[model samples]
Target: MSTPKPGKIAAQFMAHKREMRLSPAWKALRGNDKLVLERIEEEHMAHGGSTDSLPVTFTDFQEWGVRRAAIAESIARVEALGFVECVERGRPSRAEHRFPAKYRLTYAHGPKVRVTDDWRKVVDAEDAQRRIDEALAELQARTAALSGKLKKSAKQRAEDRALQARNAA
Candidate 1:
C-alpha cells in the first residue's frame, strides 16, 4: 500500500499507545466502559486537546452506541479505572441550569498540564476489577437506601392525605 498522508491520519485517528492498550487497567475495562472512555476521548479530541474540562453527556455516549442503562455505570467504571476524572458532574434538576458532565482524560494532558497516570496504580487486572466492584457495590447500596427513603416519604404522604380526607369528611 502507498504511504498515507500525515494530515489525513492526524485528522482521522485517535492514538492509543501500545503500552496503554496493554495495561491491566485498560484490559480490565468492560466493553461498555471502553465505549464510555472512547466517547470522552472523542470529545477531548474534538476540542483540539483542551483536556481541561471536556463536556460529555449521556446522550453523547448513547449516540456513540453505549446503552442508555449502562452509560452511568460505564462512566463510573472508566473513572474508577483512572482513565478519566470527572471535573463536574451533570445536574438534571432544572432545565435552566442543566449541564453535561465535564471530564479530563488522565493520560492526556492539556497545555501546561502534566499527565496523571492513575491507571498505573492498578497492579493487575484483578486489582482493577476489585476497585470497580467496590465502587459499584457502594453505589448500589447508596441507591438502595435512597430508594427506600423515597418510598417511605411517598407512603407517608399517602397516609397524610388519607387522614386529611377523613378530617374533611
Candidate 2:
C-alpha cells in the first residue's frame, strides 16, 4: 500500500476532525483527542498553510502532483473511516450534493486562540518610531525619579524634618 501525498493527507485530517466534532462520541471522549487535533494542524501546515482555505479540494491535490488513483483511493478510505460524509450542499458538478465537502475544526476542547485587531491594523513606519520615542520618555522619567530619590520639594523636606524631630523626642 502506497502512502498518499501530503495534500491529500491534510484534507483527510481535516475531514476526520470535522466529523469528530459533530459526533456524540466526541463529547463522551472529553477531548482526550487533542493529540489528534495537533497532528492535523501539523500536517496541514506541512503542505504550506495560509489564511486562504481548509481541507484542500480535489483539484488542489491534482495541482500538487497527487496521482489520480491515490486521490480516489484515499477519498474512499477517508469516507470508510467515517471522516467524510454526504451532506446536502449545492456543488458545481453532478447532483446537487455530490462534491468533496468542506471541512471545519471547532477548538471546543481547549482555550481558544484569538487573532487580535492590533495584528490586523496597518501600522505606519512613522507611528512605530513614535511609539518607541514615547516609551523612551517614560523610561527616562522613571530613571530620574530613582536617581533623585534623596531630593524633595520644599514642602516635602519640611515635613520630613518635622517628623524626624518628633521621633527624636
Candidate 3:
C-alpha cells in the first residue's frame, strides 16, 4: 500500500469533521487532544493499511508544538473517547532503547456519518410526498376512466336486454 500523505490525511480529517463535531466526545476534546489525534491519524494513514500498531513518541507531539503534559492528558482523553487505543507502552529502560508507544484509531476513524436511508426519508419527506401525490393523481384518473367504461357497458347491456324482452312480447 502507498504511504498515506499528510495532504490526504488532512483532507480526510476535514471531510469527517462534521460528523466528528456532532459527537459529544469529539466536541469535548480540547486543542491538545485534537493535536494528538491528528498526529496519530497522520501516522496511521502513512502506515497505509498496516494492522500493526503505530509507533509514536512524546517527541512527536512536542514537534507539533504540544507539551509533554498536554500529550499525556490528550492521550488519556482520546483513549477515554475510544478514538485512540494504545497498543503497547514503550519501556524506556536505561540500558537499552525501546520502541515508542504504539497506537491505533477506533471505529470512529472513518469519514463522517452520512444520511442513511432512514435519515434520507426524513430529510426528503416532502419530495417523497410529492411523488406519492402524483402517483395518486394518476391512479385516480385511471380509476375514473375505468368506472366510466363500466357504466357505459352496463347501460348498453340493459338496453339490449330490454329490446330483447320487447321483441319477445
Candidate 4:
C-alpha cells in the first residue's frame, strides 16, 4: 500500500484521543466548553485560571477513569491551549474523584489564545454567535426556498384541472 499521509495520521490520532482518552466526557465537548472558554480569554486578555480571575466553570465535564489525572490533564491542556483553567479538587473520599479539580474558563495561555487565520476577525462572543446566526440564517433561507419549491407543486393541481377542462372542451 502507498505510504499513509501525515495529515491522515494526525487526524486519526486526534479522533482517537477525543473518542477514548479525554474524560470527563465534556472535557473535549464541542461548542459550549470550547466557545465559552474562548470568550472568557478574549474578554480578560490574560490567562484566568482561578475562579477569581475567570467567571466560567467547566460546566459539565464528568468524571471518568483515573479521575484526578484526567482533571489535571484537562486543566493543563486547556491552559496550554490559552484558556483559563479552573481546578476544584473534589473531596478525596467522595465517590466521584473528578469533583475537586473543577476546571474554569480563562485566558488559557497567559494573555494569548491563538486564533486561526480565518477566525481572527471573529474571535469574540459576538463574532462566534454571529457566525452561528449567519449559518442559521442561511439554513432558514434555504428552507424557505425549499418550501416555495414545494408550494409550486400545489399549482400542479390547478394546471391538471385546466388541462382536463381544455381536453373536455
Best by lDDT: 1
> Which residues of candidate 1, in runs, are more than 4 Å off?
1-13, 112-114, 152-169
What TM-score does each of the candidates earn?
Answer: 0.79, 0.25, 0.52, 0.30
The C-alpha lDDT values of all candidates are: 0.83, 0.40, 0.63, 0.41
**How close is each model in CA RMSD to the real structure?**
4.0, 24.9, 27.0, 20.3
* lDDT value, residue 54 of candidate 4: 40
> Model 3: how large is the Cα RMSD against the reference?
27.0
lDDT for each residue of candidate 4 in 20-86, tens digit (9 for 90 to 100) = 2233323333443454444444433333322234433233233212233243344443443333444
Error of 3 at 84 (Å): 0.7
Report residue 126 deviation for candidate 4 (angstroms).
Answer: 1.2
Give the TM-score (vs. native) of candidate 1: 0.79
Report the lDDT tens digits of candidate 2 across residue range 1-169: 6777875652322334454544433332212123333433443454444322234445555555555445434433222222222132223456554464343233212123222212112144344335435544664685588557646576689999999999998
What TM-score does candidate 3 get on C-alpha atoms?
0.52
How well is each residue in 6-92 modelled by candidate 3, as lDDT tens digits?
656523332344654555556556788889977886776666535447788888888977888667656766665546667897645
Greater TM-score among 2 and 3 belongs to 3
Per-residue lDDT of model 1, residues 1-169, tens digit only: 5676865653533667678889999988889998898888788778878557889888899999999999888877888888888899886646666589898888875564347888888899789989899878876896799789999999999999999999999
